[model samples]
Target: MKILVVDDDIHILELVSIHLRQAGYTVVKAMNGLEALKVVDREWPDLAVVDVMMPGMDGYTLTKKLREDTEIPVLLLTAKGEMEDKERGFLAGSDDYLVKPFEPKELLFRIHAILRRYDKAVDRMIQVGPLLINRQSYEVVLGKKSLLLPLKEFELLSVLASRHSQVFTREVLVERVWGFDYEGDEQTLSVHIKRLRDKLEKLTNQVKIVTVRGVGYKLEVSE
Candidate 1:
């Protein structure tokens, strides 16, 4: 999963990024709200970690703006601890609030909590053709049979299934499914794609991951 971190403090931004990366999540950073929005446009993160105080667009306003169009989970991470401050944060569309001087583990806990809530809200599954992916259980069903997948492989399939036949360039898939900071190259992605396809073909050949050579890939449904 990808997380966007927005903080005016460079130290905090790097700190959060490092911790999140170590936890196996891809992290994107922004020094302020405006920059954060631009990153969001590019990364489309599953969640955002935003500081409450910024020069032009404070966390509250930014949260409100995001809520206007998207349900992307927002976690307010700032030194502001007043009851009123948290209330304002919720009113402005924050899903969780965390006070600064916080533990890295605690932050991860909250991140998982917020993401779980978001998943539940959406029913934790995406269906395309005969494939049904259960996000919570991390299982995919092709017709009546279930295929097990590793985390990265499951995420990769989720992206393709969600978009169904839409061709996705390698760069786009890397950013959307693996995060903008994906350290691997086409070889890594190709390996995962092949694994998913190999396992999927064993169960059913009704769905296929089609390669649009010189471009990218798309999921195709067959009779």
Candidate 2:
């Protein structure tokens, strides 16, 4: 997987890029928000690690821009340990937050945690007939064929499948799939749900993620 590291401090950027590369991921470096944006447009990384403070544009602004176009996971690095700073990061669409003066292991752990959450979101693939989900690999197999899913779509499916018959409100899905402390609009969950439904249609004609109208949604085995 490809990771982008955006920071004004060259030393910090180098340190993070080196460690990410060592962990078997391709690393892309950006010095400021503008540079990060350009890199994102060109490379389309699997994930991004951004520093809060910068000269050209701040991490918050960059994160907002990225969210408008993509659902790539973002991990914010903030020097300020204030609650306000952390809240601001979430409000701007970051998936996770890490305070500065952090150990490399902690950074690695956060990245792994985010990836693991993405994986867990699809921990089970319910087969109600022709549908098949390989929860371990996040692969959806449909009658001897497989479909490729984006990260958010995969996460959304996982969340619904894990609960099976249980209904989940949009608020719960946003918190569970995004993060417990996420502050983005609830509509983001709708977008992901729509995408998942569209993809699942290719496998089966049934509605796997059922809308519960006044309640929320449930993944039911089609009758």
What TM-score does candidate 2 reach?
0.56
RMSD of 1: 5.2
Instruction: Name the candidate that leads on lDDT.
Output: 1
lDDT of 1 at 72: 81
Question: Which structure among the candidates has the greatest TM-score?
Answer: 1
Mind giving the per-residue lDDT tens digits that candidate 2 earns over 1-223?
A: 6789999999999999999988877788999999888887655576899998998789998999989877678999988989999999999999999998999999999998987786566335465456666766778887678887887787777767654776777766775678656788878888888888877877777647789997678887665
Clash totals in order: 0, 2
Question: What does the lDDT come to for candidate 2?
Answer: 0.81
Tens digits of per-residue lDDT for model 1 on 116-191? 8877777678877777889889999866788778999998888888767778788878777676766866698888
* TM-scores for every candidate against the unseen true structure: 0.65, 0.56
Candidate 1: how many backbone clashes? Answer: 0
lDDT of 1 at 37: 82
